[model samples]
Every structure is written in C-alpha cells, then in structure tokens.
Target: MSDFLSSTLLFLLQASRMTILVSSAGLLIGFFIAVAIVGACLSHIPWLRRIGNLYTFVFRGIPLLVQLMLAYFFLPAAGIHVPAWVAAVVAISLCEGAYIGEILRGGFLGIPRGQIEACQMLGLPRLDVLFRVEIPQALKLTAPSLINEAILLIKASSLVSVVGVTEITRTAQNIASSTFRPLEAYAAAGLMYLVICGALALAGHYAERRLART
Candidate 1:
C-alpha cells in the first residue's frame, strides 16, 4: 500500500507540471486579451464598444467545455491545425479573458471621476493618465477579485484533459483506472490542487498588504 501510494504521488507530481504550465500560459495570455477587451469596451467609438460587448457576451455564455472541444476539433476541420496544448491554452485564455475583462470594467467604474478629471485638467496625455494613474489604481482595487479568478482558472484547467493534455486530473483518472483505487487517486489530485491554490492565495495576500502600505 505504501509503495502504491508513493508511486501514485510521484506520477501525479509529474503530471502537475503540465497543469501548472498550461494554467500559467492561459492566465498570462488571458490577461493581455482582457486588457484589450477592457480598452474596447471603454472606447468612445460605438462600433468598438459593440464588438467588445458582443465578445464578452458570447464567450461568457458558452460553456468552457464546449469551447475546448470546438477549439481542438473545429479548428482542425477548418484547416487551422494546432497542438492539443495550444488548443487548450487558447480556449482557456478566451474564456477567462471575457470574465477578467468584465472584472476590470467594474474596477474602472469604481475609480473616482474627480481623479480622472484632475489628470485631464493637469494636461496629462490620455495614454499617460491611463497607464500611470487609472490602470494602477484599477489593478489595486481589483487585485483580490483577480486572485479569486486566478484560483478559479486553476481549478477549471482540469477540463483541459478532454483535449488530450495529460494534466493532473487526467493523470489521476489514469491512475484510478489502473490501480482500482479511485478514492486515493482523486484525493491526491484534490490535495495537489489545494496546495497550488493555497500558495496563490498567500501570494495575493502578500501583494495586497504591500499595496496597502503604499
């Protein structure tokens, strides 16, 4: 039993590397996409706002599992062949970007009108004001929520298994099938997820404290 448990843990630890890689890639890409979406939604142009709204609605409404399947299967059928990992990352990015964009929009809305007006009155360029003042304040205001979203994204990454990526959940399933110990296999997987998410929460807490001091 000890041997079985030890070996199972080793295998799971190996598979978890893939999970971390995919989730990290997805979150990074999603964050950039979210910035673009927030810009479009906040744009003065009617068409740009409409497009941004449409993107948010469609991506948020669709199930993430369906999106993953479509990215992995449909893209190839449409002649855009991508690796399973690439498809998984892209699907995760698009889905998470929509949610993150909405979160950022709310953060932006929370910013004081007076501060923005002050920047304008001081003759700061729009880009300078946005980058230096608005974005920083918005990020600080939204840090906790953003960390929650990151935790959610890490959990949701299990769905990437369907795309043939052997992430932690997929590895656990495989172990359960072979070892006939579903409980042990799945419990270990759950524990791994808990550790990763707990670390993220701790990091976020530290960041929030630093921001508070500054």
Candidate 2:
C-alpha cells in the first residue's frame, strides 16, 4: 500500500476503538434499562405498566437519526451539556432500551404461569422466584434477540459522527474527503464493520448453543 493508504488504514484502525466503545457502552446500559422497563411492564401496578408502555412508544416511534440529532442539538439549548461521546451513547442507550424492553417483556411473559406458581409454592420469596427462576428463563429466551440488538447498535454507532464523535465511519468520511479516496476509505470501513459484526454473530450462536445444553 502507498503511504496515503497506509495512513488511512491506521486512522481507521484507531478510530474503530471508539465505535466499539460507544456500541458496547450503549448495549450494556440499555440492557440494564430494559430490565427495569420489563420489570415495570410485568408489574401488577397499572400506572407502572403505562409508564413502561409510554417509554417504548416514544423511543421506538422516533426515527433514530432524528433522535441522534435531538440528543446532539437540543440538549445544549436546554442547558444539559455533554461531550459528543456522551451524547451518542446516551441517545443510543435510550432508543435501544425501548426495543430491548419489548424483547425482554416478551420473554418474561412467554414463560408458563404454572412454573411461576410452582416456584411460588416452593416457598421462594417473590424476589427469590424472580432472580432464581423467572429471570433466568427469560434470559434464555431473550439471549438471541439481545445479541442481534448488539449487532445493530454497533452499525448504528456510525451515526455518532454527526455529533462529532470520531468513530470509524466518521474517520472514513474525513479521510475520503481529504484524500479523495472514497472507495478505499468506505471499503475499509465496511470491512471493519463486517468483521466486528461477524464476530458478534459467532458469539451469539455459541451462547445459544450453550444455553440449549443447560
């Protein structure tokens, strides 16, 4: 490769870390938030369920790009200043949490009620039944969907560039514009994403198989 190509590769390689960081942070945070939402949706209280439903409605209904723009642009006007990376991660976590809520809610609800009752009859406390029985089964059911969500968020991290976060996709755009090498820069970016996502897919498959055995 020429010096320019070599530098471009290095630039993208370095920038790829930011992409991974943002996506991983969002996925982890979103998972915790989704658990809370799912618990709310599953709660016996009517008002809590409504709050969970409304959260899902608002986040899932909005276009992701618009959400990104709003996070980066609107928050500052309201005096909620944050760094570009913080803005991207927060936007992604909130939006992805909505979808994850549905995934986990479906999993929790799909469990047989008889099983819950059986656990209850075993003298397990409510919290014990939830932690030891219900949540575990729900995790088994939702693992695949959660894995897919992680992959989606990784790709979506490209949009973080709009907020001035220097991730892989944004680096590609910068390199292409500066060197007039869109093909090379974009091709490299695509390959990087493919590799990252492919690894996640493999990991997900492994997890599914492991869960099957247990």
Candidate 3:
C-alpha cells in the first residue's frame, strides 16, 4: 500500500472501533426508551398515551444534528454538564428511540386482539402477557424494521464526529486534513461504513429467516 492508503487504513480502523462502541451504547439506551415508550403508547391512561405521542413527534421531527447540538451546546447553557461522548449517545438514543418506539407500536398493532384475549383467558397477568406472549412475536414481526434502524444507527454515528468524538467520520476528516487527500480518506471511510452496513443487513436477513422458520 502507498503511504496515503496505509495511513487511511489505520485511521479507518480506529474510527470503526468508535463507531461500534458508540452504536452499541446508543442502541442499548434507545432500546430501553423504546420499551418505555411502547408501554406508554399501550397504556390505558389517556395522558400517558398523549405524552408518548408527543415525545415521538418531537424527537422524530427534529434532525439528529440539531439534537446533538442541543445536547452538546445547549445543555451546558442550562447547567447540564455532559461530556461529548455522553451527549452524542444521548442525542442519538433520543432521536432513534422515537423511531424505534413507532416501529414497536406498529408491531403491537399487528398482534391480533384475540391473542391478548387468549392470554387473559389463560389468567396471565398483563405484564406477563406483554413480555412473554406479545413482545416476542412483535419482535419477530418488526425484525426487518429494527434492522433498518440498526443500519441508521451505524450511519448516524458519523454525525458524532461533529461533536468531537473522533469516530470514523472524524478520523477521516483528520486524515484528509493531514494528507490533503479527502477523496481517498473519505472514500475509504465510506467503504468501511458500507461493509459494516452490508454485514448487518445479512445478519438481519438470517435473523428474519430463523424467526420465520421457528
């Protein structure tokens, strides 16, 4: 490899590591929020349902970069001192959680009313029905959308570079600055992202097949 290619490879590796870590953490957090939002959406209480809907609308309407900027820049003005990584994670989770919540809500809607009735007739508690009977099927039904969400999460990690997280996009930017070869550096970084997303797409397909077969 030429010197430029070699340096780009090294930088890409470093950036990819951060992408994995940040995406994992953000997804975990988003999953938690998704659960809560799903519960809220399904609640009997009107207030809770409205609150969940409002939350969904607000987060979904805002661009992710704006959310990140608010967390990184505006939060401190309001006395919340968050590190760049923490802010990045929070922003990504909030933005993604809104969409995930909607996906889960769609999954919940796909469940037949008769199924819930069946669980109730069997004397299963509501929570038990949700966890054991409902959510599992919903997950299977929503697997494709969730996998798409995962792909979005992977791409969104690049935005964190703007907040100075030194993730893949940031690394690419740095390499381009030093080597004056934006095309090579950014192109390599794009390829790295493409590979990660392609692998994830395959995993999603395999998971869907397994779920369907079972």
Candidate 4:
C-alpha cells in the first residue's frame, strides 16, 4: 500500500505485456512448427523420422536457458545475428515446439490405427484424412497438455530478460534494485504471473467442459 509499491505495480503492469507478447508469439510459432514436426515424426520416410527425432531430442534435452544464450551469444559467431526480441522468441518457439511435437505425437499414436485405416479405405485423400480426422482428434485429446505448456512458457519468458528483452520479471528486478525492496517487487511480479496463469487454467477448463458436451 506504500507509494513505492503502487508505482512498482504500475511499472510491472506495463512491462507484463512483453511477457504475454513474447509467450504468445513463441506459442504461435511453436504450433506451426510442431505441425511439421509431428508430420516428420509420423512420416513413413525413415530420414524424416530420424531427423524429427534428432531435433526433438536436441531441443528437449537442452535446458531453455542454454538455448536462449546460444541464440543470442553464439549465433552471431555463426553469422546469424538477430535482435534480442527475435532471439528470445525464437528460443522459446524452438524449445516449446519440441515438447508440443511430442505431446501431439502421443495424441496421434493414441488414436487407434483402425480409424486411420478406415479413413484410408473410405477413399479419403491422405491429406483430407489427416486434416479432417486425425489432426482434429489429436488436438482435442492433447488440449490439456497444450494449455499446460502455454502456461509454462509464460513463466519461462521471464528468462528473456537475460537476453535484454525487458519483461515483467526484468521490470521487477529493476524496481527492486532501485527501490531496494526486493520482497515487494518480487511479490508483485509473482502475483501477476499467478493471475495470468490462473486465468489461462480457468479458460482451459471451460474449453474442456465445452468440448466434452459436444
């Protein structure tokens, strides 16, 4: 309730948008890439399956912080420089893409082979079968895991500050340093994250209920 806490809240509220933006952007990128990854994993082609497995292993095997550091620090040496914002988003996207691919793969595999076989026998085009039947069902089955990953990404975005993209956590750090009130600044930051993630969870629950009714 102090004036300092009030101003700190204002600063974090403004910067929190960056957290949402980065997380949303990352997730969008991940979704698109994951489609490809899932395809690669499911491919009858041996090379594609191996490549997809390798990519997923590498990304999921490494910690995200390491990925962000490599994107920002090491890529320049390889002459693939990007802005800090781009680096942060790319790191999150690639990392989350790996996990999302696995989640979707599970969904795909969970679907009985009879369904795919039936679609094939029904004269449906391969693409049509995939888009209309398999992918849709896979997504529905894995919706909860997808939502959970999204929430995790929002919190993980706090690490983007290390690459110089000022998000809510970075804003809190700044206020904590300047005001010498680490407890208040960090507490506010945690509450903001909790609110955002809680809202997402509630929304996901509602979606699942609606899906069940259908």
| CA lDDT of each prediction against the hidden true structure | 0.91, 0.89, 0.90, 0.90
Residue 10, model 4: lDDT of: 86
Q: Which regions of candidate 2 fall more than 4 Å away from where they truly are?
A: 1-3
Clashes of 3: 0
Residue range 1-214, candidate 2, lDDT tens digits: 5787778878988998999999989888988888888888888999999999899999999988788899888778989998989888889989988999899888998899999989878888988887788778888998898888888888988989988999999999998898888999998899889999999999999998898788
Query: Candidate 1 regions off by >4 Å?
Result: none
Q: Model 4 clash pairs?
A: none
**Displacement of the residue 33 alpha carbon in candidate 1, Å:** 1.1
Backbone clashes in candidate 2 total 0
Instruction: Give per-residue CA lDDT, model 1, range 1-214, as digits (tens).
Output: 8898888889988998999999999989988898889989999999999999999999999999999998999889989887898999989999989999999899898999999999999999988988898778888899999999999988999999988999999999999998899999999999989999999999999998887777
Better of 3 and 4 by lDDT: 4
TM-scores for all candidates: the values are 0.95, 0.93, 0.94, 0.94
Task: Give the per-residue lDDT of model 4 (tens digit) for 1-214.
Answer: 6888788888988998889999999999998888889999899999999999999999999999999998888777989878898888888899988999999999999898999999888999988988898888888899899889989998889999998998999999988898888999999999999999999999988887776676
Of 2 and 3, the candidate ahead on lDDT is: 3
Q: How do all the candidates rank in terms of lDDT, highest first? A: 1, 4, 3, 2
Candidate 1 TM-score versus the reference: 0.95
**Considering every candidate listed, which one attains the maximal TM-score?**
1
The regions of model 3 sitting more than 4 angstroms off are: none
Clashing pairs in 2: none
Weakest lDDT window of 10 consecutive positions for candidate 4:
205-214
Off by over 4 Å in 4: 78-81
